[model samples]
Target: MPATLLIPLYRDEVAPRFDLAGEALLVHLDADGAELSRSSVLLAHASSEELCRIALEEKVRVVICNGIDDEFWQYLRWKRIEVIDNVMGPVDEAIARFRADALRPGDILFHRSDA
Candidate 1:
């Protein structure tokens, strides 16, 4: 199965992006460790809302990121997609941790917006 990881891109480990919607999502195929960067990234020229649309259209299964708005959290949860928040450390390490099942439904996460 595939996982959707929503990561808030920051110069360092702290702080949110200038735009609340201006976040990057790294999608990875759990089994093979293959990343879907080129085919999935929709922030090159589109608005954040558009990118969110793309994620839903692409059937994003998981979202791993630093932080997300309460609205998007509810939307994703309503769609039954898994989400991970407050992610730090290297992206590779995060992925590995997820695979090891060390991460829980709300381990690195908070309210699902729906809650």
Candidate 2:
């Protein structure tokens, strides 16, 4: 079986706040964790309600994002959507981690600068 995942995007990285995300990436993966399809969805506006509606409409199984409100989180959970919140990094790295079943809440995938 295949499953769908959603990631709120800010340029090439994961959006810092779910309620403020203006775009999202939808990915479909096979039972073996191989990607079946990926597409970007541009929101009409940045709104948690809108995002929630989109998630339901798209039948998203998972969501990767940061700074989600507890109300929204609980709602998604109640609706059976798996949310991995507080992630910070490039979208590609996050997706790779997810595909490998290593992505978790509060993960920071960005490299630190020594400077």
Clashes of each: 7, 0
Worst 10 residues of 1 by lDDT: 10-19
- Each model's lDDT comes to 0.54, 0.94
Clashing pairs in 1: 4-62, 4-63, 5-64, 6-63, 6-64, 6-65, 7-65
lDDT of 2 by residue, 44-115 (tens): 889899889989999999999988999999999999999999999999999999999999999999989972
Leading candidate by lDDT? 2
Angstrom error of the Cα, residue 26, model 2: value is: 0.3
Tens digits of per-residue lDDT for model 1, 2-53: 5655544443231243135344545556555455552324365424456456
Model 2 RMSD vs true structure: 1.1
Alpha-carbon runs more than 4 Å astray in model 2: none
Q: After superposition, which runs of candidate 1 have C-alpha atoms over 4 Å from their true positions?
A: 2-8, 11-25, 30-42, 45-48, 105-115
Give the C-alpha lDDT of model 1: 0.54
